[model samples]
Target: MLKFFSEEIDFKLPFPQKTSKWIKTISESEGYNIISLNYIFCTDDYLLEINKQYLDHDYYTDIITFDNSEEEGKIESDIYVSVDRVKENAETFGADFEVEMRRVLIHGLLHLMDYTDTSEELKLQMRAKEDECLLLF
Candidate 1:
């Protein structure tokens, strides 16, 4: 199952059913199944508070993923996305909001799939994976 929600924001994901299918396609292509994935959209402040409270970090990020996948080849997690940050990143990257938002959205699922970007090399790999997923999106 896949769901979308908002926290301290008024946002709607366009074509949610299509989004769910796209996510499922990515998961299956990578040899996994979706149990439940929730996308919670929020303002920067709300997400910042969550980051500080849960992660003990004092910096803002576009997305925060909570990995709750308890079984092998399954996905069960909550993905928090900062709308403000997404908009800013879109402008910075010279891409439209929809494109950037999709990138961030899949970025979370990629994390749950064991993709890491803690180093430059890994970041490149992550980006490549993201691009590959974007083509399916």
Candidate 2:
């Protein structure tokens, strides 16, 4: 199941049904099944607090994923996304807000699928995967 929530932000996700279906397709394509996934949208301050409290990193990030999958090929996670950061990123990158939002959404799922952006090469690969997944919408 895919669920959406908000913290310290008054926001409603656009196209919940379509986005959920697209996410399911992305996971199945990666050979994983969705057990449960929660997307929490929040402000930069809220996410920063979560970063400090949970990750011990005092910084603002676009997304922070907490993986809870217990078995291989299954996915369970709590994905926290900073709506403030996404809006800023969209303006910085000259991209549409909805497009950038979807990118960030799938980026979290990609992490659950074992994709990383720790290196330049891997970052490129991850971006490519994100683009591919975006095209499915």
Candidate 3:
């Protein structure tokens, strides 16, 4: 199941069904089944508080993913996305808002699939994967 929620932000996802189906397809392609996933959208301040409280990081990030997958080939997670950050990133990168938003969404899912970006090389790989996934959109 895929669910979307908002915290201190008045927002609605454009296409819930289509987005969920796409995410499911991505998970299946990575050899994992979606157990349950929640996408929580919030303002920068709200997400920053969450970062401080949960991760002890006092910084603004586009998304923070909490993995809850219990078994192999299963994916469960809470992906918190900061709408404010997404908008800013879109402008900074000269990309469309919807396109950047989709990238961030898939980026969180990639994290749950065991993709990391701690290094520049890995970040490049992650970006390539995100671009490929975006083509499916």
Worst 10 residues of 2 by lDDT: 21-30
lDDT of 3 by residue, 1-137 (tens): 89999999999877878888998999999998989999999999999999999999999999999999999889889999999999999999999988899999999999999999999999999999999999997
RMSD of each: 0.7, 0.6, 0.6
Which candidate comes out best when scored by TM-score? 2
For residues 89-122, write the lDDT of model 1, one tens digit per residue: 9999899899899999999999988899999999
TM-score of 2: 0.98
Candidate 2 residue pairs in clash (backbone atoms < 3 Å)? none
Error of 1 at 95 (Å): 0.6
Once model 3 is optimally superposed onto the true structure by TM-score, how far is the C-alpha of residue 121 displaced, in angstroms?
0.4
Best by lDDT: 2
Which runs in model 1 stand beyond 4 Å of their true positions? none
Q: Estimate each model's TM-score.
A: 0.98, 0.98, 0.98
What is the per-residue lDDT of model 2 for residues 1-61, given as tens digits with 9 covering 90 to 100? Answer: 9999999899999999999999999899889999999999999999999999999998899
Candidate 3: which stretches are off by over 4 Å?
Answer: none
Worst 10 residues of 1 by lDDT: 13-22
Q: Order the candidate numbers by lDDT, best to worst.
A: 2, 1, 3
